[model samples]
Target: MTKVPNVFFICGNGLGSSLACQMEADDVFEEAGIAVNSGHDSISDAPSLNADVIVSASNFRSQFANTQIDPKTKLVYLDNIVDKNEIKEKVLPVVKKIAES
Candidate 1:
């Protein structure tokens, strides 16, 4: 069986923005045939999530630099959290490559 990737959408808090992004991520991953176990979390929980890919608002990209996440994991910075088009553009290609590997 193919290993499903773990994708986490993170924000200041796990409740709001991250939740919105997670919804979009679900649809995007489903359409790409990239089976993913995804969810939302606070930025503080990022390192512990062990996500194959970490996604956050563009503004928070710098903050992840100090986290303990693996250097090989993909990081996606999005300008719009709820924009499926933007998510597809920034995230889908990387996910496809990961699935292939």
Candidate 2:
């Protein structure tokens, strides 16, 4: 079985966007042969834990301070916390490749 990629999602405030992304990853990636587990975390929380990807809600993007973020961590900056379908369509490819490796 392929190991699903974990995604750590962050936002400016504790809102629905990050959680939405998590659900999208589960629905979309699972169909594509990937297992996904995502969590709501702050920018500061990211460096310590391991995650295959990191996403930021569009409205609260700057709170994510990219300079402090590790270059090795894959990131997806969504535009205005769009629909779950959009997140799934965009993120699945990366998730698929990462799981395969």
Candidate 3:
């Protein structure tokens, strides 16, 4: 069986915003007919996950700037974690591509 791509959501703390984003992403991918394994974690734990895709709030961009991530991992940023439209727009294409592969 093909392995599903992992989409990880990151935030300052693992328990809050990242979890919210992960939930939204789950719905977004499901509605778009894409299959992925989604997760949530603190920014500090991000590099260790090595997920196929890493997503975070736009504000966290600099936190990941110097962190060494796998070259193949796709990074997605969202302006609003609760906005489904923004999540779909920013993440669907990347998830689709990874799912297809």
Candidate 4:
């Protein structure tokens, strides 16, 4: 079997928003039959996480712009973190591709 991808949900602080988004993403992945190893972390911890995928609100785009992220890591930006439909539409495809790889 292929290894499950490690996905991290990033926010300003590790405490609130990232955790909430991670919870919602868990449900979305389960429904989509995608198995992932997921977690929540602050933006400061992002580059070091070495995740296959990193997800966060679009506002963090500028913050990540200056960071040296791994070329293989896939970033997914969402306008609404709790929106399942949006998550499915945006995140699922990247995850499917990563799984295939």
lDDT for each candidate structure: 0.87, 0.68, 0.88, 0.89
TM-score, one value per model: 0.91, 0.75, 0.93, 0.94
Candidate 2, overall lDDT?
0.68
Local error of candidate 1 at 28, Å? 1.5
lDDT (Cα, tens digit) per residue for candidate 4, span 1-101: 56689999999998798888899989999998889999999988888997999999999989989877888999999999888888899988888788777
| Candidate 4 weakest ten by summed lDDT | 92-101
Measured by lDDT, the strongest candidate is 4
Greater TM-score among 1 and 4 belongs to 4
**Total colliding residue pairs, candidate 3:** 0
State the RMSD for candidate 2: 2.5
Off by over 4 Å in 1: none
User: Which pairs of residues have clashing backbones in candidate 1?
Assistant: none
lDDT string for model 1 (18-86, tens) is: 999999889988887788888899988888887888889999988888788888789999999899999
Give the clash total for candidate 4.
0
CA error at residue 101 for candidate 3, angstroms: 1.3
Q: Write the per-residue lDDT of candidate 2 for residues 1-101, one digit (tens) a residue.
A: 57767777776543576676666666666676666777877666667658778877665566665546666768777774546666766676777777777
- Clashes in each model (backbone N, CA, C under 3 Å)? 0, 0, 0, 0
